[model samples]
Target: MAFRNGTDSWVVVMFFMIVVILFPLGVGPEPDILNKISSGVIWVAALLSAMLSMDRLFHVDYDDGSLELLVLHPQPLEFIVLAKVLAHWLTTGLPLIIVSPLLAIFLNMDISSYFVLIITLFLGTPTLSLIGSIGAALILGARRSGALLSLIILPLFIPVLIFGVSAVEASILGVSSKPQLLILGGLFLLSSALCPIASAASLRQAIE
Candidate 1:
């Protein structure tokens, strides 16, 4: 299903790149200034990019009635929600990670921080998807659900964003990023364990 919506994925990737590109243009082309803000800029763009496609996570299935079938399946709805979240991460989050190196270069991020940026993104983006899933499910059938989904999920995304940027910033400053990375990992595990179940419950409520 995600593959079928390839255009959305492309739009997200383009948006991520464009946002990063805009910072250089808007903030002036000074490499020093860009370097200072690179981690935050990239992370913010990734967060918004992730949110861009979030509404589609379950909306298509819900609209087409596949969500109802999946909910009614003998298999646990949580597993179904988890699978969809994984697909969402693959389509949306994975692209951000893949394209981030070039964006990092564009932002004048230090070479040493590149690895930490990738690591943080890898750890953080799935958590974004998982947590976003709950909001996506909650906003099902809602009018202007895209805005509502943003409102519901943006606060939840802040922790991931903070730690993700902090990890990269630490590396740039020649400090250890392990603490932030560990926290990001913990967030991923926590969201992985909890978000699916929460999303599944919301999905049930939505369908009713």
Candidate 2:
């Protein structure tokens, strides 16, 4: 289903690129300035990009009654929710990581920081998708869910963003980013354990 919606996937990637592109234009092309803010800018763009496609995470399933069927399935609904979240990350978060090196260049970030940036993103983006699944499920049938979903998830995303950018910045400063990366890893593990169950419960409620 995620692959079938190629346009939506591309939209997420485009939104991410545009956000990164705009920062260089708005902040001027000064390499030093761009370099300094690069980590934050890219991380923020990624967060927003992840948020962009979240509304549709289970909207289609809900509309077509697939959600009810999944909830009624013999297998656990949490596993089903986990699968959906995995699909969402593949179509959304993976693209951001793939294209981030080019954006880092646009922001004049150091080559040395690229690996750490990618590492942080690898650890952080899935957590975004995982945590986002809960919000997406919560707003399953709510009006103006896009806005409401953002409200529900944005605060939750802050910690991931903070740790992600901090890891990149630490790498750029020649400091070990291990601590931040470890924290990101922990966040990912925590979200992975919790979000699918929460999403499954919300989906059950929404379909009730």
Per residue, candidate 1 scores C-alpha lDDT tens digits across 19-73 of: 9999999999999999999999999999999999999888888899998899899
TM-scores for every predicted model: 0.98, 0.98
Report the poorest 10 consecutive residues by lDDT, candidate 2: 1-10
Candidate 1 residue pairs that clash: none
lDDT digits (tens) for residues 49-151 of candidate 2: 9999998899988898877888899999899888888999999999999999889888888888988999999999999999999999999878898999999
RMSD to the hidden true structure, all candidates: 0.9, 0.9
Q: Any idea what lDDT model 2 has?
A: 0.92
